[model samples]
Target: METATPFKLLLVDDDPQILLGLEKIISSHFSGDEILIFSCKNGLMASQLLASEPINAVITDIKMPLFSGIDLLKFMNEQNLACSSIVLSGYDDFNLVKNAMRLGASDYLLKPVDEGLLINALYELKKQSGQLPSFTRQTYSLTSILKMQQLLEGLIGSSDISLPDADDFEQEHHISGQTSCLMCYVDIRRALYSNYLTMFQFLTDRVESFLNSSREIPLLNPTVVYGRLDTYWIFLLFTDEASFEPEKILEPFLALLTKDHFKYSFTTAWYPYAHIRQADEECRKGFEKYYFDLPYAPSDAPANWQTLSESLDAAAAAAAAYDYASTIKNLELCFAMFNFLSPSISDVRKEMHHFVYSILNRNSAFIPIISTSKFTDYDLFEHIEKSESLSVLKKHLYSSVNYLIGELIESMENKDDYVIQKAKEYIHNNYQDNLTLNDVATHVFLSENYFSTLFSQKTGTTFRNYLRSFRIEKAKELLTTTNLRIYEVAQQTGYNEHSHFVRAFKAITGQSPGDYRQMKK
Candidate 1:
């Protein structure tokens, strides 16, 4: 068996006895690797020492004489250090613990820490740090996050980023295992960028601290990844298959944030375990569901992310099938309904931004034509607050939706026929269950035979052929891209019989399901 890398430890305290005590306890409890202990009376000395040496982990006292632990934490943040930190303080220093957490300390222990607790914290940190052989005292900077944000901004109007190809992401990210959930939060109002940044920083700080403090449930430290588009943040938490309930862990933190800070309201969405690399796509789906399909008000009840997702998926498909005039008319009704149902401009804006972002992000036909310039310009709340006439607001809503629909139509004209677009939409809406071309044609008010002929004429394929192609495409996606079994794929893509699915798979690709798996290998 191969031995894991040793963790480099840095113990900081003003008192020699306390430092010696920690050294003794850590030496006895953790003997597999070398422990580097740094005795510093103040934060300034610790900062200087950190500047000169590599410290994997830092254990410091909160109430040191000169430079305090909080002061060192601020320095760490400014310096772009990634080392995990533990704060050692008196029991009465609850406020200090909060401050340390806000500054990104991984965990904190009371003075005269228990031997077991100290060892547990160290062990947890070791697991999180991965292959880091030693702890390096370093500074933390927001440069990487800023760079990622910039990259996201660049994707705002690009077509290639549409709905993100899950297979492409798996190949790029090199993800090999299952992920428990994909979590995401989006700030609809662009003006709140600064506030969003602060909230994100706070969330990262608190989550890191919480994970470091707990030894029983070891979780993979989450990373900030780009999502379907540039407007959201994604985190992929790899948890045990049997022990995942991400909502339970996330709710308290969300509640604290909403209650403590009254300036802005927040909405959250989550997707259950799927492929780890498809995290961005799942998060995008979550954002669309929460922001578009669900009600905007904060509720005591948890949002049903799966239901919202299904609804939005259906709505998007329906919207895509409308003729130019019908499309405009439907959007008008949607906006009118929105105007009547939503109580405030803030709520309306949130809903509209979500709806528009989701539709624009998923449909490549709409993105290039919709003016990115105006998406951020209008303040719906300002209009709602100033105008008393419902007529004016209704008109504004109509125009906004109309503009979006027009952009969609214009983009689609160059890429696909109207019937083909409608057929694509139908496939998307019914992809999860048993569906047939005749069923789709009936829904669209066309004769089964006539619709099939038209679909084949417009799309260069028979309706049944198209349905098979679509199902096969989705099945191929599950096979190469997800861990879901062949039977599950069959069920998910509308085929009920496992043997039927296998025969169809072989007929289309000239390979058995097992053979396809081996080919992928």
Candidate 2:
């Protein structure tokens, strides 16, 4: 039978009773494990011992003489020591607790600590440390390991995958005896897909730095793996044991990532202890759910599968039936909702992309058209940088939304339905020449009658009537804004016959062009 490897531990406390108590508790609870309990009356002695010898983890009293736990943490961080740390403290030391956390203590427990809580903390330390052992070993190349570690860290930050399979990983790397937890799935909105690779690489580096400084887990065994699948990125976290709520670990990390780096929000799906073989499929489901279910603004962190599934189903239904006009209205509403959330521009962009893509992907044809357009390729950062004010950003978003909707409509197969667009384009390009509904319909490859019906359906007016209204609106503008004569206005507004223009203008505006101009004057 294979012997269970004993976990190495180091305990530091000024009081003899506390040291003896921890020793007894650890020995009794973890009978098969190796326990190294060091009694130090002060932080100075503990620091000397730490410098001289290797230790897997440390449990220290906060108020030790000459050197405090915070001081020790600073010293360890400066020395770049790789040891998990927990603080043992008395109640009513709120300031100390806060300072210790700032100094990088993984967790703090009050005096007379519950045995279970102590054990759990130790287990968590072991799990975190066990998941990341390469950071400590001498045989691994630091640069290559660092790169891999960075990728794993990004996966942890972006998705809900908890630790990779430590046993299999250890065997491959020739490092033995490690345990890990689950994998996380991270889905960035497809509109942001172009930035996914670079952004993830940057995020991965930051996350690794964070995890490296974390005293709660060991860095020697990286527990996370960041993988890419099409437009989404996946993160797998490996750990010795799964304890504490997984999201509790992930949500704050994502919040920190969004706050510190990108202005975008990230959605994660967590699979605790997911078998390696099933990870890809499980992650796909998670990615689909996240992409489809993201809210208009960041909400409370999601906790379970049921809510995620429900949200996705509702969003999919909305996408399937969404109209461009309705989408514009919703886009404005979503902008308002984002302001209410007070999220950074990146977060807002993430939500916006998810919402837009969910709607756009409803039609398969819409995807290819939008994918090939400049509107879909616009960079949020570039837009934000160029915007003079929030109002400008709002205008930019609205314009892009309108453009995307127009493109989708343009890609439809109904030539008759496109008469209005053809008419508008034609009139825009050839307003100085003779132009009419017949000319526009023929240009758009539509017969007069069918084009009239489709144009009316599209523009809510017959082609001839619509042209008359459009030309008259332009004539009124030129009448007031320019010193052009009535005939010149008619010619500029697409009517060659002056009398016909006057009659048509009067029929629509209930006033001759001269009367309208005088009224404005």
Candidate 3:
């Protein structure tokens, strides 16, 4: 079954007793994916949460003081909030249910709601009413999505999908081995899907078709998605077929999906597993990052998306002009600005890729992205997005830029191609830390003088001058994007002497650091 999108669920009732019961039940079930649940003793407060938060469903008692549940229902309709509403009523309140139903309440539950009945009612509402939650750009990993689906299936009032012991959870409850289950994770690109549930139905039906065609008895491998997006699937693999690939289903699905409109493309991973319980611990373990990110609030710093965007555009211009220092500086500024937000590390993946894509996107008329990254199969965006912290993100970002620059320096002589590539990778990675020519020369297993000679011969500059230029460009980025003292910028870019740095800055750019910063400003 497709999981409910993370929603704001409001509980409104005058009686604390009923409010407590409903909270307990729903909290036990249907609350996750960062779902926010709020309870208020009156409609007045519930209405406020509805206004302030992204509420998708509301459960309200029919009669209450000040503002009654009926009044709340009427307000929802008047405002065109169109949220799914379940009315709670007494045995004597069927007359009120008549009014609530007329007012477009989804369904009514009697006082002291039965757990199974409430679940079944909500399930039917999702199916019949077509009131599934909407999508947020937030993307969860495939493992996280599946683990969440398992939790919704297992629990009644729990927020966590993880088990204390995977072995124990599996032992206590396990899928039978007789059923050939295949766990498939599908990544939905932004362009390929619009509504979540419809795409889900399409994939599930496709999987069932394969199962139905199976020569095995009782052969329909029931297919379902675990999350709101058709991102993860648990289905049966057919043994009768010589080979079974979900690609058969996906091929047709892709045919119908417009490729040009695709905002993001995804890879699919399928595995044959005997039982979910067998390796579920690993699945939950992989999802720990998602769980860790639950407490996230967007960075408090005001977003300057336009400024960050413009910097990347400038970096592209610099790259096209062979201003390696300026290109690196501009791109580094983009990463540095990213830190001000202090966003959840997992959330930054998409944003980081966006910036890297901005640079690579310019490769056609400028530096070719393939020649820069293809030799190493460096999926810079993927690596950067998966980083677990700001420090790592910065590290990945610079390494990618350096790799591109190193590749751009592909020599016609070819003698220093390998040596220069290795050297550039080292400098890009270690520039912000402690880096030296000896460190790089040792890394390439060449003597300092020999490596230095080859580098100079290929680039027409001594290694020292090139390294200095690279650091100065990097320092220029920090000068513009950060408020660090000039000395700090110098130190960060592998310069120690303040006077020496000043002279070098003036020598290369014909201006002091302060002057350069003003010019950029």
How far residue 236's Cα lies from its native spot in candidate 2, in Å, is 2.9
Candidate 1 structure quality by residue, lDDT tens digits, 1-521 = 97655666777788889888988887876564545455676789889988887778899999887888999988888998877899986634768888998988877776656564576567667767774344442223467556545444332223344334444444454433453454444432221222344435544543454445544544554433432234334333434342535555554544533433211212233333333324444444443222223223323322343333344344554444543355444444444454334444455555545655566666655555555524332333343343323444444444544555655666554543555666677687687777877788877677888888878778788877777877888888888988888898899888999998898888899998878977997
Estimate, for each residue in 210-262, the C-alpha lDDT of model 2 and write its tens digit: 45555474334445555444444455555655454455556545554444322
Clashing pairs in 3: 28-156, 28-157, 29-156
Expressed as tens digits, the lDDT of each residue in 1-521 for candidate 3 is 98756556788988888788877776676656634678899998888777777677788998888889888988888888958888987644768988998998867776546564565455545554455544333344556655655643452113335454433444454433343343333333311222344445544444445444543433244333333323333332322222344445345433333221111122232333344443333332333233232223224333476666677677765554335788777766666565554455555566655555565564453235644454343556556645444544455456666656665655324646656765776776577666777888998899998998988887789887887788888988899999999898888887778888899899889999998998988
TM-scores, one per candidate: 0.33, 0.28, 0.28
Of candidate 1, the 10-residue stretch with the lowest lDDT total is 260-269
Cα-based lDDT for every prediction: 0.58, 0.58, 0.60
- Model 1, stretches more than 4 Å misplaced? 1-354, 372-395, 406-416
Model 2 TM-score relative to the real fold: 0.28
Q: RMSD, each candidate, Å?
A: 27.6, 22.0, 22.6
Best by lDDT: 3
Model 3: lDDT to the true structure: 0.60
Model 3: how far is 276 from its true place, Å? 31
Report how far residue 236 has shifted in candidate 1, in Å. Answer: 52
lDDT of 3 at 159: 31
